[model samples]
Target: MNILIAGATGKTGARLTRQLDEAGHHPVAMVRESSDTSVLPHGVETRQADLTDLADDVCEGADVVVFAAGSGGDTSEEMTDKVDRDGAKALIDRAKAKGVSRFVMLSSIGAGDPDPESDLAHYLEAKHAADEHLKASGLDYVIVRPVALTEEDGQRDMTIGDGVDPEGKAHRGDVAAVLARAVDDDLLLNRVVELESR
Candidate 1:
């Protein structure tokens, strides 16, 4: 499978790209011209496109799309809305137009229901809109809502679905593993799952 990974240079996306490559799948790193490609695996395929300004051909040749992109914590709420909400929706639409097989979204835990009082409210709201968009996109989809993220190594032992503890933290590596598996894993197809380190 040829998987196009948005945010492929970021921590989790980078890990996911390598994992897919190691698993003998072709991983296409979707990046901006300014992005640092050094973190990507050697000889990995790349497609240059900015999340904020995507083209119709962005999803061309992709069998699946993993939206692992985000406007960083330091970015303004407007930027978050642009990248997280609008950018995601745009990509989803493009993928649908290009006939991509599946979409795997990396959403945060509280995205299903945002708390207005929380500091991450805006971020969660943006994600919530995107998640809803994906659900209604009429495409095969998998939404992975992981709790707080950590930089720890992947345990690969995860508590998924109803067994997930909301307060627990998930390792980025483990999240990456889950995202890569969602590409074609029949069990995860069209399902929304919460993830936590076991």
Candidate 2:
């Protein structure tokens, strides 16, 4: 299967690309710039791309597209809305237009709850809004909502089941790996699932 990863420069994105290669899958990574991902599996394909305005024909071609894009911590709420929420929405729309079969999204866990008073709340609100959009979109989609993220280097230690609530922190590596698998055959038809460490 050919998998396209947006925001492939992120913490989980890089590791996920490697795992995809190990599983004998084609990994197409999209990034704004180049980086050490050069050492990624020889099978991995990297492209200079921005997900903000995705083209339906381009996005629809992927067997699966994982949206791991995000605005960094230094960004403001307004930026979060543009990058995280709006950017995500654009990707979904394009994927649907392209007739893509699967879409895996990385959304923050707290996004489900509504709280816009705090600074960080703005980002969560935006994420939540994006989540809603994806849910309503007519595409096969899986939205992984993780809690506070940690840069722990390890495989996924948690097995999140149905009704699982992403209310706590999980390693970015873990999240990435799970999202990749979801895009693969085992969970191919699964619609949506949230993940977090216990």
Candidate 3:
């Protein structure tokens, strides 16, 4: 399958890239020029472009678009919107324009919450807005809102289900494996699922 991985340089996205590479899928890594591209191993297609401008042809002929991009850590709502909301929106718009079949978003657990008053609320708000937008865009999309992230070393052996507390925490590698599997599964289609490690 042809896949476009946005923010492929991030932790989860990086692991997904490796998995996709091993699975023999055509993985296209969409990265910003200034962002580090060292994480994603060799043999994947690398396209340097900013999400704000969201250059086209990135996802053309692609079957899936995995939006795993984000602007790290506490910041203004403006920055949050730019990288999380507008960034995801730009990829979605381009995916639709290019006729991509599916879009998967690596979101956060607080996405369904309406209040944005915590230290991380702004980030959650940005992700939630993007999730809402994707759901309303008339496309096949899955939004997985994982719990608080942990930098714990590789845990691809984990599992996820529907009833876990949205307040739990998860390993970054586990989230990466989830994205890796999302390309070929229908477990969360057209739904906003909150995830926790098991």
Candidate 4:
């Protein structure tokens, strides 16, 4: 599959790109012109694109698009809305325009109903908006909402459901594995799955 990984320089995105390459799939790292992609695996294909202003041809020829971008911890709420919500929405639009058939969104566990009192409420709200956009975009989509992320290695064993334990956590590597699987798994089509470590 020709998979376009937005935010390919991010922690989980980098892992997913590497894993897809190792698994004999074409993983195209979609990055911004200013992004430092030196940490990415050598010889990996890369395309320059700013998700905030996605071009119509950005997703041309891509079979699947995976959005792993975030605004980062230092950014403001507005930035989060732009990158997390608007950026994702832009990519979805491009995907549809360019004939990309599948999209996998990495969302947060509480995106469906963000708690107003939570510290992450703003972020969750942005994610929720993006998830809703994808659901209505008329494209085959998989929304993976993982709980707290850890740096542990990929275990592959995970519990996937709509209402998993709130206290559960997921390894970044394991989450990447699931995203890779969603690329070709017909069973994951149009599903919003919450992921947690078993």
The digit string of per-residue lDDT tens for model 3 on 1-198 reads 988898898877888888888988988898887878878778678887788787777677789999988887866678788989998988888888888888999988777885657777778788888988898888898887788888864556554656767667788878877777778788767766666776
lDDT digits (tens) for residues 1-198 of candidate 2: 888888776777877888787878888887675455664666577766666555555564588888887888898777888889998888888778777788888887667786767557878888888888888887787878776788885566775655555556788778877887788545635455666765
Sort all candidates by lDDT, best to worst.
1, 4, 3, 2
lDDT of 4 by residue, 22-80 (tens): 99999999988888898688999999998778888999889999998899878999899
Q: What lDDT would each prediction earn against the true structure?
A: 0.96, 0.76, 0.81, 0.91
Model 2 lDDT vs. the true structure?
0.76
Count of backbone clashes for each model?
0, 1, 0, 0
Clashes of 1: 0
Best candidate (score: TM-score): 1
Candidate 3 error regions (>4 Å): 157-159
TM-score of each: 0.99, 0.86, 0.92, 0.96
lDDT of 1 by residue, 1-198 (tens): 999999999989999999999999999999999999999999998999999999999999999999999899999999999999999999999999999999999999999999999899999999999999999999999999999999986689999899788889999999999999999999999999999987
Scored by lDDT, the top model is 1
